[model samples]
Target: MLSEGQRIAGQYTVERYLGRGAFAEVYRVRHRFLGRQAMKVFKHVGSRAAAEELLEEAVLLSRIGHPNIVRVFDAGIAETPGGRSAFFTMEYVPAGNLEQYWAARGDRFTRIGEAVDLLIQICDGLAVAHGERPPIVHRDLTPQNVLVGFDDDGRPRVRVSDFGLAKRTDAFTGLASARGTLAFKSPEALRYRKGDSPAGDVWAVGAIAYLLLTDTLPFHDDSSPVAFFGVPRDAPPPSPQIRNPEVDDELARTVLHALEPNPARRAADAAELARLLRGWRNPETRQ
Candidate 1:
């Protein structure tokens, strides 16, 4: 069902397979005219109706262009063995993903300076997504979706990927499945038919931070996604200090606030979360 060296839109040729998931297969590709690109051929859009939805996705992405978000160079369909289907050409992130990076170098991020740097980039990315007219929710912020690398200037860059599974505050994703990672899913998301909010993203980001600090995910377990959020009455908090004492009080508290079971108590949105992180970093203000 899958082939190689396939060209999409008669412009980009698949360089190699990058990764695969239930809904999409990402490939490293090069353009005949445009140079290098990461082509994600989404298996989800197999129908004529789904093919038409590309316009909205393109529009949505075009509206939220930020340095921290993955750049969408072009988006359109490439023919599959069956017929015309979906494919999107995006900026190729050379540094791979955050999980692999973090796993390969764990104790280094335990340093407050590096951890703070990574967190700020994530906040900036979330701010861009949440600042949309209707506010967008990533609905998933697991380590796999966050890509890390550096720019020509040697400054670290973190780009959030995979908007296909995301949702906006005012709308539901057209897909019929739950649209988020189980461990990162907020309490409401675990209980309801669908859950999407800026706070949800904040919580998921907090989960990522927790993992980095502790080197283990407390709530992440072998459970149906439904089971995790279904009974949130007794969800327990994981202590980063327990894992790494260097994970100072300020950062731990901020992370905990975002992980609150109730959305009302969570940071107002990604902006609020970013504001807290920024203010916490100011020594004079903290004093």
Candidate 2:
């Protein structure tokens, strides 16, 4: 909702509106001295206590600092045209998100090696959170939540972003509430059967990998009325190779294993998935 040129707390000047979700609006802003950064302003406007609650995402990102994770720089309450809004600033990646990157591939599927590499980087980032004392679960893991950019050497660099729904699991249950994009959610999460855990995050990673390889969701069927509710539970998703013949058995197995309907059968967590992906060679370099 912030217009370009607007200044927040006299520190960051809005460059442009990036996007918005259910509860927050993101803007590309320029820090007075620190160059460019992205600012996320929570929609809720209220007292200091409420603002503090909205700043949880910033706090969470600060604690889980990793090269594959977006970095939070600052957080505070800023006066907006609407009212006092809670805002946080983080590094801005110019190449946009994974969704855009995937879409740009158009009719062609992402290269097997490139897709696997990206997934591995994503897992690396999530692994840090999963390794936390109580274990943090990124309830929302979608292409839109992952930022894609280039490093100084021009190699693709991916960072897990949008931690708005991320939370540390309960010490006793090791579970967080079931909440995320339906297409990427685990069967257990969609049914509210076991809440959500590290396994649920792994499901999302698998879904993303499947999409990258096949250019379609693993279990999505637009024609089915049940699709609105969640993935069909009675049957497992088809292997990625079925849609894309280029997908080899080893890669297909790795992707399908992550999409297993049973959490117990899926890849243990992001760390395990990363390890599995490391074995695959980039298609362009495969001998």
Candidate 3:
């Protein structure tokens, strides 16, 4: 990890260590003129191939430039305690990630309408990637990957971050090798039956929505032996209303639809799920 106050490429100065994933360490940094940004430095280095792999996330982020997606500002090689490393800088979100946002609510569940609104924004961001000619599937879509902040007016804003495992799907089957968090992964993904696709992303969004509304995961056990054998096809996840009575039938149905074990039966992609969620009318405002 880069120490606090360390400067990189003579442009950004590390403000503090942010976090680390399997392959990279993140730091909050200050740009020479542009204020603060998040710098992700990959652990792997020393080879041309490794550098290319590290640059993939930056390239993908640059390609899919959207307000709902984290914006990439710069990418280059940097010196770290470990050695020379590949790194990229992006916008810094003060509020952290969706997981932290959810946890901040404490005992109270995120309001059903607010949860749905966040999911819509996430879907809108993913739609840009999925709408690509070959379609880019975000194999990983856990809450930790979704950054939550606020807009200029203080309204909640969410940006889909972390495209480390994202990939362009096959033109014909629209699938890529299955890889992501077990709890949020689709049934097909868990079993490696058909690989990851847009439908898989929908399942992830559904899982996040479920957690936000009910404060519980639809598929609770990520470490269960069942995960290795594949989630039981016969046993469906519990309804959201079972945990959160505030979740009306329409909202519950929408969440469940995205969790369908059969990808063919679920909403085709984030775009379709966004449409379904957009149709929901807030209970408090409905007169």
TM-scores of the candidates are 0.89, 0.94, 0.95
User: For candidate 2, which ten residues in a row score worst on lDDT?
Assistant: 278-287
Best by TM-score: 3
Cand. 2 TM to true fold: 0.94
Q: Residue 283 in model 3: shift from native, Å?
A: 9.7
lDDT of 3 by residue, 1-287 (tens): 68888889999998999899998889999999999999999998777567866899999999999999999999998777777799999999999999998788675554766788889999999999999989999999999999999999988888999999999999998998888788888888888755799999999999898889888888766788887546663355899889988888989999999988888899988999998898885445332
Cα lDDT tens digits, model 1, 1-287, are: 24678767778777888898676788889999889888777675557668757545555666788888888888776678766667777889988888887777656544666666677788898898888757787777788988898999987799888777666676443212346778877776777746567877888888877777777775755385446655742454866777778878888888888888887888867778777777777756542
TM-score of 3: 0.95
Clashing pairs in 2: none
Q: Candidate 3, after superposition: displacement of residue 202 in Å?
A: 0.3
Q: What is the alpha-carbon lDDT for the whole of candidate 1?
A: 0.75
What ranges in model 2 sit over 4 Å off? 222-231, 282-287
Candidates sorted by TM-score, descending order? 3, 2, 1
Model 2, residue 40: C-alpha shift (Å): 0.4
Q: Which scores better on TM-score, 2 or 3? A: 3
